[model samples]
Target chain A: MLPSSTSDKVFRSTLFVLGGSYVLLVVLLLVADLAYSSWGQLAELLGKPEIVHAIWLTLGTCTAAAVLSMLVAVPLGFVLARYRFRLKWLVDALVEIPVVLPPLVVGLSLLILFHLPVNGVKLEDWLRSNLGWSVTYAVPAVVLAQFAVAGAFAVRTMRVTFDQIHPRAELVALTLGCSQAQAFWRVALPQAWRGMIAAFTIAWARSLGEFGPILVFAGATRMRTEVLSTTVFLELSVGNLESAVAVSLLMVAVALVVLLVLRGLGVERRA
Target chain B: MIELKNISIVSGSFALRDVSLSLQHGEYVALMGRTGQGKTTILEAIAGLRMVTSGDILMDGRNVTRLAPAERGVGYVPQDLALFPTMTVRENVGFALKVRGVAKAERDARVHDVAEWLGISRLLDRRVTMLSGGEAQRTALGRALSFKPKVLLLDEPFSALDDETRQEMHALMVSVRTHTGVTVLHVTHNRAEATALADRVIQLEAGAIQ
Candidate 1:
């Protein structure tokens, strides 16, 4: 029983080697990209008011999208996971559509549909006049696009999280004079909090970096609905490589910090 | 008192055919079966987590087969003793009362009473994740008993504990039953647990009670 220490050592060494190599490859690419850009350009772009506005817009829209998605996705996910129903597979597939769909194609579809005429007037006008949302070339459009993709992701993640929680916990709560809603809030929700946090973080991060949808559906209008990614695109078109690099660097930093926070919360891995 | 009349269920790979059982008032019964015998399935069907293909579940002389779980008045503790790890012991114990819109003062009083009864008063502030297996089971039992349910269903309640903790939990169960007079329907793979706690034992094979 005490034998075979040598083989164990070899196996552990091999695992460490593989893990180290994978990490090194990603780190090396990041280092190379940073080295290619000058620090002065990165710093200059960081100080720009437009860049600040873009950062705020990106953060704001992403926060809204992620929060909205979670509000819808959590209950939907719980229902899908707990209940067996007709057309369940269809609902499940719909929740996962964004994972397989191309982001650019999704953006194009949103722009084409939203800009097209419905009955007589353009959807852009109807949205503003009827729905009270000035969606075209604005914050609403950006959020809509982000929500379209991120909502799907949140639903899928939340469904899995609900599945991981034991159904008995909910049953216990129900028997103890707790209503269904109360059981979910007090029992299931607390046990699955880590997963919800993780799902929200992922959706938020994805929305923050959304480029194709913002560029196509929302348009890259300066100081209007321009987000971090859109700002980078606008800078690139005008030959402002320094600003573009700077914005990109800022985005990377924010994402890294967020990722660290998520990890600290113990949601990143388990969720 | 609870009764199951001609219960039957068929999932993809498992089936329970014409299973009938009854638990008398304040009775302590244990359900025993080998793996793949649909022991948990029966419990789930009674709890409204599984839809019975055909059955009538009566609680206190009223048919509750079609009722939702929240309406059935059946407290359940599953095999894993799934406690909310993020919540404190007080929150966990007070959850059912809180959900029923009980006043905060009343909820706290109930929580304190239950915690004392379960000998978990000192652990009111501990995260469930930090509790020992015995402690967790007590907390789970406290959660079930806090609202004074008519029947308590425990699935393999002591399967995860060491021998010492298992004995401790068995003693605690006896104490709980003695003090509260709550009917207990326990399911266990371990024979000793059934022998120790069950006033009656129902042996299940292939989803039918023997």
Candidate 2:
């Protein structure tokens, strides 16, 4: 028998309550952020030269990291989605490690990776002596830290994007005299442009909010590698709640604008 | 001629066991089978989209079973038509030539000629997504024939068309075979489609030729 009218009403209400609770929590968080930081406070924080420099640093590093993410993610995602190979499960598991591992642990892991001895020489020392460069606690380290984690997110997104696409078009391209690479560029890559944009957007946002890894791998050096997240940290450590909250609000505003732009492009429907 | 010599293909739980088939040069043939039969599999094998466990695929009397899809020199239109969604009709039709680094002038000329042949000249500048079923079919056919491959493979080409469009495409198939003189292997479960398009009809039952 069908559910009774009263029970059906209760069930429908339960569904709304369950979904609405999550929405309510998100709205409450936004409202709390807005209420805690005032326009005057935001303007005051923006007037600081260090804060301004940090904003530029955030944009530069995030873009660099996100671009790097796509460079590796697109090919890795395509391979994972379309081809079968031995140890595929291992690769798949490795991709998810970043998304699930504690953020600070990713930072610690990078620090250890640089310091680990290989062939009786530390990697950071080898790099400094051979290439006249060092990765530990450097600007490059910031980008590397963000990419290590964000690239995994980008790869997962691209994998889903490629999975949704039919392989027949690519196969047909091959039949039409396109080599494998040509077919990917002409057929699969074009169709995947939206996903690429979405992937870039997500990677940028993820990189933007990265703090734990950047903190441990690239120390919070003023005027050197400080980003908005680090700015928030430094502001809070000095008991400057206003500047911290102001920076938090700024990050939220930037993230909101990005999501709105993605929505306007209508990629959220697919991605 | 297009030939499959004692080929076997194993895909998951399904297998085409020791299946052999042939189509003489310039011949228009239809492959018919039930839903679970391997009609599409056979077409994919010939197009080099799928691997055969044991057998030889030959086009113009040269073994191509070991060749990549691009090296096999066959044109394939899958059941869904598999038109490049990101390209315009002209680009889709001219894709093969463009990939081979053909000169733009020559590519445009051949694209125009193929579009004209398929009665899709008016649709060349249109996006692939904008075309009706019949228009899309013609565009796909134009694309397949643009490079003048040795053989053309069609899988369920009319399955998505309305009755009127299906009849129209049958006439287009006749013209395509006559104009190109390319070997044609059309796969379908519909006997009427086979009757309407094929000079010879082959049947498959559970991956074996009947």
Candidate 3:
């Protein structure tokens, strides 16, 4: 048998190198494959007006969804992190259901909800007539589907962030002549700025990669609801593999650039 | 004057039971106890951070049992200081006044005055995370004092300081009390600290004052 110290060292070193290399290798391989496939087609894809429009649509809708998610997540996360009430576990589970549910299921459920009759009136028809907007197979559906899943991630991140903060900060603010709202806005929310950035970034990135829900709920209509992910899927279905790879590479480049910018701006999650 | 009449609090497995104490106006009282003996709990109870299950808290003969912490007009410096790390020292010190919608000129003036008094005038532009232990404590004290609270609750305000710094903080506390005449309730486990800072030292055992 090996000496206890030597065996322990070996075990740790082996696991560390193996685990570290595994993650790095996967990412490197994916990027390399995309680069190789799209080497000549990237410029062509970029030149296409439809592809350019899809990229812009993805950026816009993802940003809107991420911001909307944060607006919902902040208060919900604060309540979950700070307060105690009846069936709090139930509420927590409900918030998390979207995270665990299949993306396709989320799309189907939302589609079903919009179709359901409310008070003897069809919900979709009522919304279209009253608000002059359509949800199914529309641009709004893309945002809604992205929000359904991405908002769950935002909530989870925010909850963890608020949980890390000492509640005494808010309490101290209160004792220092701040009303509840004042204490939250001044003390608690300021403390959560890094977390807010993290949540927004995670939700935005998740929204960018979202495919199943967007495709199922909002059909891939060119220059309308088609995002980069949908663009990739459409190109692949048309047997244009190089075009698909080009769009995928664009997504990877954007994600890397945005993350670098955020990090450069000193928005980081503290332990 | 502040009074806790038969105050009791139960938080999870730890509890403070039937705690009663009274401090005269402008009095500096130190609460001493072993760890887990509810010294901090008592201070929190008085600061309105914890709800007493069955007791009345009175301040200046007014029952403030159900009043929120802000309305209670108390200044609290918790054990860890709880400085808003994201804000500059000036902002942290001026937060109470800012939340009250005090004008920019007045708020800046008051923050400057408090920072000067705390010997933290030079550190006002620095972030709270950038300060040393003593500086953070001074900034926290300045923040608590910004609103000119009638009562001040300090939980081991000097526990993390070195010997020389702790001595300086003790002197600062004495000066603050003399100048402002704010009632002080300090919680500390160190007997010498309690003896050095308090007008009357109260010993706590199993949540009761002895």
Candidate 3 residue B137 Cα shift, in angstroms, is 1.8
Per-residue lDDT, model 1, residue B3, is 94
lDDT of 1 by residue, A101-176 (tens): 8898888888888878878778888878887988868889899899989988888889999998877667766767
Please name the candidate that would achieve the greatest DockQ relative to the true structure. 2
lDDT of model 1 at position A19? 99
Candidate 2: DockQ?
Answer: 0.84
Query: Cα lDDT of model 1 overall?
Result: 0.85
DockQ of each: 0.64, 0.84, 0.80
Which pairs, if any, clash in model 3? Answer: none
Model 2 chain A: which ten-residue window has the lowest total lDDT?
A262-271
Pull out the clashing pairs in model 1. Answer: none
Q: Cα deviation of B35 in candidate 3 (Å)? A: 2.4
* Model 3, span A1-271: residue lDDT tens: 5566978998988998999998999789787767567556888888889988998999899999999999999999999999999999999999999999999999999888989888878878898999998989988999999999999999999999999999888988888888888888988998898888889889999899899999999989998999999998999999987778778888888888877876655544453
Give the poorly placed runs of model 3, Cα more than 4 Å off. A1-16, A31-39, A267-271
Name the TM-score of candidate 2. Answer: 0.93
lDDT of each: 0.85, 0.90, 0.90
Clash count, one per candidate: 0, 0, 0
lDDT of 2 by residue, A1-271 (tens): 5657988989988999999999999999889889988999998888988888888888889989999999999999999999999999999999999999988999999999999998889989999999999788888999998999999999999999999999989999999888889889889998998888889889989999999999999999888889899999998999998788899888888777866786667555443
